[model samples]
Target: MTRIEQTFITLKQQNKKALIPYIMAGDPNPSVTVDLMHKLVAHGADIIEVGLPFSDPMADGQVIATAGERALAGGTSTRQAIEMVKQFRQTDQNTPVLVMGYLNPIEIIGYENFANLCSEAGVDGILMVDLPPNEADDFPKKLQHYTPCPMNQIFLLSPTTAFDRRQSVIDNASGFIYYVSVKGVTGSNALDTDDVSTHLKAIKANTDIPVCVGFGIRDGVSAKALSAVADGVIVGSELVRHFGDDSIDTKTAIDNILAKMDELRRAIDG
Candidate 1:
């Protein structure tokens, strides 16, 4: 099994939820990104979503957009990010690393080269936020080696999506399913557990694959809530806010968020 698949199975057997954390590559600094990655894993992150720096990020909020821009400015190209995965693999091959980003960077790098590079780096899978399966004709072939998982957005205006559609998405996703808990973009408010439960349980009814919920997950309470229902939880923007380069209290802020995330993972696992 793939690293991503094994991690989820391990958590499932333990009767615990997975804690996945995302941080933009080359943010704060290129060197610091890897350091923070290991620190997070040491703390309790089962899956690490390495944000590949992009020029324009649509699905992201202001916080992540800024982080991406900074990483781009720091010269965090697709190659650099992939190298980070290679370095990460050298030490901890157990934790799955998923490259999360826009299509522009990979487009510039050439999809064939990007996929080969990711496979060589031991990357488990990818979650291209803007790349939908309907439009899979354009890039799916190029990313064949790198498994793609569609993010499921539970919304009100759309009412709900049919099972056939979600099952198709799950089939496309080789690693696992990314269940977007809310309708809007990232960095929103806390999701109501009832809304999340209804939607996720519906998803669970369709497939046996692991489901990881993301977006607007702020603290221990929020993480614990999502973990209680879903197979796992993903935190990104909140972690970005922790690495505040502009703030005088950057180190302390990062330490605080890291500590809380660790504690939250313990709460879920223990």
Candidate 2:
């Protein structure tokens, strides 16, 4: 099984939910990516979603958009992002690492080559925001060439997903499914737990695969409420905000980030 798959299974066994945190690669600066990644694992992150710096990110809100821009401006390339993951693997061999970003950079390197690079970098999965399951027919074949073992081809499910499309996603998807809790871009809105629970119930009825809620989960209260229904909660903007502005010392920023992670962790596990 892939590390992601194993993680969910293990969490299920322990009756504990997963805490997945998202951060932009090279954000704030390129020098801190690896250290921050390690810090994430240290602070109870079950899985880490590392965003590849992209020039154009349609689904991202201003917060994540700015983070990506910072990474790009700092000379963080796709290769450099993968290198950060490789360095992270030196100490962390268990926590699953997922690359979350647009497809442009991966296509530039060729699909097969990108899969190989991810494997070499110890990455366990990918969530390409713009790539739909139907359009990714050839990707699995290419991925198999490099990854003989299972690797998550994670997909997104939103409130607007039709029955057929939802089935298609569940049929094609591996690992846990990412359910966007809100209709808008990341960091643009707040979550309604009742609505989230209703939607999550419908999704759980369709597939046995674990469901994870993201995009509007920003704090302990929201994370805990969502985790009661879903297998995991993904915190993006809120965690990214902990890094603060350039003026904040890197050490202080990191401490704040870890403190937030620990807070969310306790909420989920409580």
Candidate 3:
């Protein structure tokens, strides 16, 4: 099984929900990305979603968009992001590392070449925000062909998604389904747990694949609320906001991020 599949299996057996944290590669600088990744695992991250810096990130909110800007300014490219994963794999062979980004960089690198690089870097999965399942024809095939284990193509399903589109995403998704909890962008504050629970019920009824909720989850209370219905909780903007602070040192930034992660982990495990 892929590392992602194995992780979900183990979590299911233990009756525990996954805690996935998102970090932009080279947020403050390229040197700290891998170390920050290891620190995230130490603090209680099950899966780490490393964001590849893009010129334009349409789905991200101001917090994450600013992070991407910092990353790009530090000279982090798509290849460099993959290299960070490779460095992270030196010690962390178990925790699944997913590369989350837009599709333009991959297009520039070419699908086959990007697949090969990801496979070599030991990337477990990929989440391209703009690539719909219907439009992704040969990319998934290339990933599967290049990797020793099948690389998962994680897809997003939002509340606004039509039934047919949701079905298509569910059918194509492998690692897990990223159920966007809110209708707005990544850091929007409009989270309603009751509505999330209702939508999750409809989604889980259709597929056995694990569904992880993301967006609008900020702290222990919200994480706890979402964990009741989701197989996993993904914290992005809430976590990324802790990094890239000019006033504080990188160590302090990571400490803040880990403190938040610890709270989320405790709440999820409770």
Candidate 4:
């Protein structure tokens, strides 16, 4: 089984929800990505989603978009992000590492080549925000051809998604379904837990695959509330915001990020 699948299965057995944290690879600099990933794992992150820097990230809010800009300015590329994952794999063989990004860079490198790179780098999953399941008929085949184990082709579902499209996404999804808790971009505020719970009921009725909620989750309260309904909680913008404060030193910035992670972990576990 893929690392992601194993993780969820293990968590289920433990009666615990997964805490998935996101970090922009090469944010501030390329050298810190691997270290930051390790720190995140140490701080109770079950899965790590590493953002590949892109010039245009439509789904991201201002916080994450600015992070991408910082990473791109530091000369971070798709290859660099993949290499960081390879470095991270040297010590962390258990925690699943997923690369989240747009499809432009993959297209530039060719899908087959990208699949090979991710497989060799020990990447567990890929979440291309713009690639719909209907349009990606051959992408999973390419990943399976290169990867010895199954590589998760993660997909997103939002409140605005039509039933037909939601079904198609769930049918094609492999690792887990990323349910956008709000109808806006990442980091937007005002999460309605009741609405999220209602939607999650409909989704869980259809599939046994783990469903993770993201977007608009900022703290332990929100994370804990969502954990009641979701198999996992994904925190991106709030965590990423801690990393982008230029005034703070890298060590201090990372400490702040881990502090936030710790808060979320405690709340979820409770």
The TM-score obtained by model 1 is 0.88
TM-score of 3: 0.97
**Residue 98 in model 3: shift from native, Å?**
0.6
Q: What does the lDDT read for residue 132 in candidate 2?
A: 92
| lDDT of every model, 2 decimals | 0.74, 0.88, 0.91, 0.91
Model 1, span 1-270: residue lDDT tens: 567777878887888888988899988668777777888988888888888888778778888888888787788887998899888878886778888877777778876677777888877777677766655553543444353422111111111445666666655555567887776777878467779888888777867878888888888888887788888888988888766556546567669768877777877775
RMSD to native, candidate 4: 1.1
Q: List the residue pairs that clash in candidate 3.
A: none
Clash count per candidate: 0, 0, 0, 0
Pick by lDDT: 2 or 4, better one: 4
Clashing pairs in 1: none
TM-score of each: 0.88, 0.96, 0.97, 0.97
Query: Model 4, residue 127: displacement in angstroms?
Result: 0.3
Q: Give the per-residue lDDT digits (tens) of candidate 4, residues 1-270.
A: 789999999999999999999999998789888999999999999999999999999999999999999999999999999999999988888899999999899999988888888999999999999999999987855564455535888999998899999999878887899999998999989699999999999999999989999999999999999999999999999988876887888889889999999999999999
lDDT of 3 by residue, 1-270 (tens): 689989999999999999999999999789989998999999999999999999899999999999999999989999999999999989988889999999899999987788788989999998999999999986765565555545888999999999999999888888799999998899999999999999999999999999999999999999999999999999999988877567888788888999999999999999
The reply for model 1, stretches above 4 Å from the true place, is 137-164
